[model samples]
Structure formats: structure tokens, C-alpha cells
Target chain A: MLDTILSFFKKKESSKDVAKERLKLVLIHDRSNVSPQFLEMVKGEIIKVIQNYMEIDEESLDIQLTKTNSEDGERMVPALVANIPIKGMKNAGR
Target chain B: MGEVIVITSGKGGVGKTTTTANLGTGLAVQGKKVVLIDTDIGLRNLDVVMGLENRIVYDLVDVIEGTCRLKQALIKDKRYEGLHLLPAPQTRDKNAVTPEQMLKLCDELKEEFDYILIDCPAGIEQGFKNAIAGADKAFVITTPEVSAVRDADRIIGLLEAHEIRKPRLIVNRVRADMVKRGDMMSIEDIIDILAIDLIGVVPDDENIIISTNRGEPAVIDGKSMAGQAYRNITNRLMGQDVPIMDLNVSEGLLSKMKKLLGFKTA
Candidate 1:
């Protein structure tokens, strides 16, 4: 019910919003030179490797490329961070 | 010594050459010796824009290749005596002149001229590289659009990598009506994302088109809004403090109501 009310008040996306969103997505790929297919392949391999060790929640997996400052805060660096939920260990409860 | 400033934009048709012609003319009109260099090579248009296409006996490649002396190659502007143009060769491509050659040419010109403005070609290629080789400063121009601003950001990053610590920004062809209607991005929105110091903002004026067609820079026209903006930018370039021109549309009751409803108005 609250979601519907919030959605009703939400402003419509204008042409400027669409353009800004498109630029945001394209610039990330352009700067990193990474493709969606490559990211999918990497995700599949990572999930396969993790599943061999323990049960995992694949649906909850998230991966993203973001910009972060270097150690000395001198330059911007592209970082790939991931989060995956673990269901259970393969062998024992421990 | 003169300062070599490169007018560059990664995207095409964003008014790099137009800005170069105006700023060069503006400086010359201010009693400064200025030379405009068209580094676009095969796709040269500055000659036509400056209305000196008929007087081109020698081009940039000729001066660099020793085919003609620099003085013989420069085409003098009829309107402004202090303004000259070194046009690009229409036959050869970007590879005809190297970065080293450009640096040497700029070094020789610096001894005589007060300003050396290089009009860079679009895209981050060899032409762009050679254009900036001799520039002590860079002015990155962009329209207040998503694609143009994105390209401008990329160019800024590339300029930083090339050790150009400070690059100014010029937002051109801005629309006041659209901004008042909450349809177009405002200057503040653009500056927030680009994170560069704003040098100038030119309103969308139709006189610019007429002046371009006439091969006369609009900066000399006192009635043109864009011309006024260029004059302010030129003053800023000369270390003078000139306030940016106001581009705000008249605030009617409807606009005031729209603003009260959380609508963003430029």
C-alpha cells in the first residue's frame, strides 16, 4: 500500500533523466573496457567454484564495478566488489 | 612570450572552431597579436569560417615540411590586422605533421604573438594528440547534453594524464526556455558532474549562425547574446574579472507556481 502511494508521487523520467542514465551506464563500460558477456562468464565461474565448496544463494549474488580512491587518495581506481550469501557448508555444520 | 591554448572537444560540432575563431578575433581586437592554427588537417574548415579560404597560398603542413616559410603560410585577417591564421592542409592527413613539429612551430611563434590558439579536431586520436603537444593550457568546450558532457569528462581525464593540470570548461548553446520549463539540464547540473571551473556559458543565440555564415565572428556584434558571452570569456582569458551573462527567462506566475511544486528551474 505504501509502495503504491510512493509510486504515485514519484516524478516521471524526463528525456534528460533518460540521457543521464544512459551516459552513466555507457561511461562505466567505456572507462573499464568491460563487456556484459565477460562479466557473466566471470560470475558463472565464480559461482561454480563457490558451489563446489559450500551451498550458496545464487539469487542473492551481486557484482558491480565502482570507482574508488587509491591508497594515498591520489588517483581514482576501478574496483570490482562482490557479495554472495552462503547457505551451508558441504561437510559439516562447523 | 605567447600562450598556446588548445580549443578541443571530444565530440564533433560542439563549436571548437567557432570558439577558436571568436577568441582569436577577440584577442586581436583587444590589440593583442593572435594566431589561429587549424589542426584538423584533412577536414579543415577554419579557413572557410574565417573567410580567408581564397588567400591560402601555403598551409600548416607546408610550414612544417619546409615547403614554405611560416610568414608566407599565415593568412592575415582583413578585419583585424593583428589576427592571422595557419590553416590545415586539405590534401594531407593528421600524420603529415608530428607532435615534435607542432611544439617547434609553437615555440617559434611564441616569440612574436601574444596568443596561439590551436583548433583541435574531434575524437581522442593522433590529431588531438598533435594539437595539444604545444599547448600550455586547454579549453574543453561542450554543450549541456549528456553525451557531450560525458565526452568532455573523458577528455578532462585524458588531459590530466597528459600532465595538463588545469583545463577550463565552456558550456555552449544553452537554452533558457527549456531550462525554465524543467526540460533541459542547467549549468549548475553540468558543472556539478564535470567538476571543472566554469569559464563561460553562451546562450542559444541565432546571431551566431548568421555570423558564421557571413564569416564574421559574432563577438564583434554588440547586439548578439552569444557575442556578449564570448566577450566575457575573452576578458576572463586575459586575466580580467567579468561576470557571466544572465540567461534567466522572465519569471511569470506559471513559472513561479511550477517552481513551488518542486520543479527544477534554471
Candidate 2:
């Protein structure tokens, strides 16, 4: 009964899904010719600019190279998606 | 004027040569005059795959170097009166022919044949450039694997960069059983990633190996499923509107019996 319950709670992901996800991630970097260091630099710059206006949780900051529908929705294009947690905004006087 | 179509894959061993041989023969079977050129110099395989290796007297390098006339280098296939092959030089490398020479040669071939299918060397190198330089379009071939698909994407990008716009995709060696079990990538998954128009999807059939072993294309064998797939592709290439073959339809009683008996069904 315990094993059945445990199995029920575990999500089964198809290997093809895993392959698709991995291909999408790798192709994003390949198409843009962007390295991990380049992404790191971009993340640092973005954080610096955002930090000037608000306090952010650097530890929780997540940046990824991904794909999204183009403006016309005709095709998929490479996109840089970032999720940064905001602690608080800076004082207006400062 | 004949259309020069280059069959290419970014990675090796994805059946680029096989696809070329099959499609070339398929076109010839349709009564269109076709000539296949092997651009993979020093590693020529199209001739062997077509079962015409022993008949090669002159090669692409010989024609380009003016050592032999263009007509003298082309080996006509006795099986198909409309088909011929220009084998690559076994001793030379890809550097033997330049893009200009290839372009000129393609122009010369355009007057005689209805289709010129260039079996491209794998990878984005001088051989690839030479192969595509004279072509009007391209067909990027890949198997249903991550590495092949990734390399295919790279090849597509390179083809577009070289002004070969909107190259069609041929996803080869697909295993329908694995796809049904979610263990293999489907045609939809590959098309979703590549985002190119699909010309055809060839199922993984053991007949391809058997046919290659005999130095004949799977397309020549009417009983082979892969051969039927190539026939469909050939029709599509000729502006015919044949629907893609339904690979799942074969999973009937025979296959079920094979599965029950623990036998591998092609």
C-alpha cells in the first residue's frame, strides 16, 4: 500500500518529453551563439540595472535562454527570460 | 533546365547518401532523367550504395580537372535508362573541386537531365559549399535522434545563410513503435524544433540495410515500407500531392503476433 501510494505521487515523464526539453534548451544557446559566460555577464548587467531601482534576491535570481512565439506568432524565436525576486524598492530621495 | 538539389545532413551516418540514392532512383523510375553526383571526395559511398562502384572509370575530379570529358565521367545505370552517377575521386579530397567549377558543372548538367541530386558530404565545410553552390534548393536529411536533429538545425541555418532558402526536411530512420511508446521522438517533435516544411518521414526498416547490402536503393523494392516512403517523397518532389504514409497502420495482427512471440518486427 505504501509503495502504491508513493508510485501514484511520482510523475511519469516520457523520455521524448525529456529529449524535447533538452533540445529546446540546447538549441537556444546554439542559435544565438551565446555562451554560459555571456549569459552570466548579461545577468550581472541586468541585476546591476535593476538593483539601482529596487533591492533584489540575488540568490534566487534565475535567468535562462529560451524560445517564445515571435511578435507575429508565425515562428519561434530565441528569448531571454529572467525571474528575479524583489525585496523592496529604493527610497525616492536616494 | 534541370533542378540541382543537394541532399545534406550536418552529422554523418544519418542516411544522406542513402536518401540521395533512393530519391535519385525514384525520380528515374518516374521517367525523369536524373544524375547523382557524389561530393564526398576521398570517402565516396554513393557509387557503392548505387551498386555502380565497379563501373566507375572517371570521377568528379577528372571532369573538373579536364582529364576527362563530362559525358565520359558519368556512369549510366543499366537498370534505369534515365539515371546516371558521377562518382567522386577516391584518392582526392574535397578541395579538388571549387564552388565555381561545381556551379559550371551543374549548368552543363542542367541541359541534359531533369534532376541533378548531389549527395553532399556531412558537416558544413568546403565539400558542403561545393555541393550546394550549384544547387537551386536543398533537402536536409536527419534521423529521429537528438544529435541528428541538432546537427540538422545547424545545417538548415547554414543552408539559409548560403541563400538556399526554405530547405525541406526529411526525417529518416523513425521507429513508429518507439514513438507510440513515447520512447522515441515523433515527427511532430522534430518539426516543432526544426520549424521547416517536412518533405517526408521514412520509417526505420531493416529493408534499408538489406537493400544497401545488395547495392540497391530501398525505393526499388516495392515490398519495403521505406521504399514506399521514398516513392511518396519522390512524388512530392515532382509536385505530386501524395499524402505521407501512415506507419502506424502496419501495427496490425501480424505485428501483434510478432510482439506476442517476442519477435522484432521491422
Candidate 3:
């Protein structure tokens, strides 16, 4: 049937996968007891500190709470991952 | 002493009362003396679900306030030999009974019954506190939906905070067909996220509604899939390692026919 042929070309990612990904992200923040506002405040402070040493792109800065394996790789732990794009380095002898 | 078990779900309408009714009845069916205490206070309905609404002469409030003896408030279910129900007062709110009172009541009931099942009200409030006050074990019920599971996670945190460690989870209203189609979350997916021991998974079935309408629990019906699921849960509660029921066996005829025609159902 045409439907069966079309199905072969369709995206394989199901909604349940999307739900799992979303739940993982939400639960990480929930378990870590960090609110979006709290993360934003922390980001602002980090930006302020980073600006003292280097020029960074605040618009494209990405910060989020995610899960990462622990040192022993036996447990998953909450991690604060941040991507701060450095534009330029500030003068050292200012 | 009898074990006090609290049935709780953070979200409303996730089958907490129904689970309580069926499990309590199922335990009695297995020759265990059981008592189900509805702790929803003003929104009490376990009595109706058990078909004991008209027999409630005295309620939990009466026993707590010393208006009646504990023995006077316990309603014996004629259908089940060892089953009894302590209905909540229809007129009173959650404040009518305190955690201390509930603890005392559970202590008294433990002396008489083999299993004391408390049906906890929804939300993390006074009702929830009172229901879990005397529970030696807790069963956290949840559906596959995101909101219900999120609330259940919060409840698990609260239960551990209250020293009710490692509360087992019961996932209700699971649709096997939906899970097969990758649309609904499966039991494994829910358990992975919640990170709790799975006690049981009940498929969504019309028999639950039919039994509720008749003021009788589905556990009494031999043919109902949900009833068989409850029987399995009861066996697990009694320390028997019963395997989880295979939900796919009850697939609808249309799906079976579709598969027969060589069509991809999922």
C-alpha cells in the first residue's frame, strides 16, 4: 500500500522518545532543586565574572542542568553544563 | 501486628481509591483479615466503591473525636469474610483528624486485622500527611502521563523525607496497544524515570468502570483483566513473587485481524 511505502521514509523518532527526553531534562532540574530563574541568575553572575577576563557572546550562551555519569560510572549525577562562546581575550596589564 | 500500607497518588483521578478497594478485597479473598480506611475526609468515596455507603453508621471522624468506639465505626463487608471498611466522614474536612489521631487509629486497627490499607487523598496536604502517618509501607500510584509521573516523583521525594523509604510504584491505565505504537509510555519507561520498584501495571480496561458502577471491585470478576492484575498485585503484596501479567494477550480483535492481513499495526 502507499501508506506502508510512505512509512518507510518517515521520521523514526516517536513521541514516547520525545516524552522521555523532555522528562529527563525536567527531572534533572527538579531533582537538583534548581529553577529556571535560579539558573538564569547564576548565568548572569558567571557572565559578569567571565567578562572581567574575556569578551564572550552573552546572546548565544547556553547553560543547562543535565545528567552525567559519576567518576566510577556507576551512578548518574546532575551536572551544570554551560557553553560560553569566547569572542576575544582582554588585556592582562590593564 | 498488621502491616499498615498507604495507597497514594499526588495527582487526582489516578486510581488510588480503586486500587485500595481492589487490593483490600483481594487480600480478604486470600483469607487475610483486611481493613480499608478511606482518608479523603470530605471527598470520601471508597465506601461507595465497595458498595458499603449505606452501611456507614459511624465514620472515621466519629472514632477520632471519641463520639464512637473504633469497633463501632468499622463496617464489615458481607461479601468478603475478613474485609472491613472504615469510611471517612462526609461532612468533615481534612482538619477533622490529625496525624496523631490517625496513628492511634492505625495502631488500634493493627491489633485486629492482618492488613490495614489506607486510601490517601490527592495533593501534598494535611490529608496526605494523615493518611501516611501510620503507614509502615507505601504504594505510590501513577499513570503514564507526564504530569502524573512528575507529581509521583515529587511524592516519592516527600515520602522519603517523611521516612517512608522506597515506596513501591503502581502504574495504572497503561495501554499496551499505545505502547506498541510508541505513543504511550511503557512500564519500563515509567520505572526508569521514577527510579522506584514497580509493584504492578494495570491496563486501561472498561471493566474498572463497570465494576465501579456496580459498587463492586473488579478483583471479584474472574474474567476482567484488571481483576486478574489486582490478583497478581495481591500475591506480590503477600510476599509471593508473582510475575507481571502479559497485557498484550488481551489485544482487541481488530488489531488481531490487522496483523493477520499482513498490515503493520504499529
lDDT of 3 by residue, B30-117 (tens): 9999999999999999999999999999999999999999888999999999999999988997899999999998998899899999
Model 3 Cα shift for residue B31 (angstroms): 0.8
- Please provide TM-scores, in order, for all candidate models, with all chains considered together: 0.79, 0.79, 0.78
Q: How close to the true structure is residue A34 of candidate 3, measured as C-alpha lDDT?
A: 26
lDDT of 1: 0.85
> Residue A33 error for model 3, in Å?
2.9
Each prediction's fraction of true contacts recovered: 0.36, 0.61, 0.54
Clashes of each: 0, 0, 0
Candidate 3's error at B136, in angstroms? 0.5
lDDT on C-alpha atoms for all candidate structures: 0.85, 0.88, 0.88
Chain B TM-score, model 1, reads: 0.93
Top-scoring candidate (DockQ): 2
Is 1 or 2 the stronger prediction by lDDT?
Answer: 2
User: Model 2, stretches more than 4 Å misplaced?
Assistant: A1-11, A34-94, B249-266
List of chain B TM-scores, one per candidate: 0.93, 0.93, 0.93
Clashing pairs in 3: none
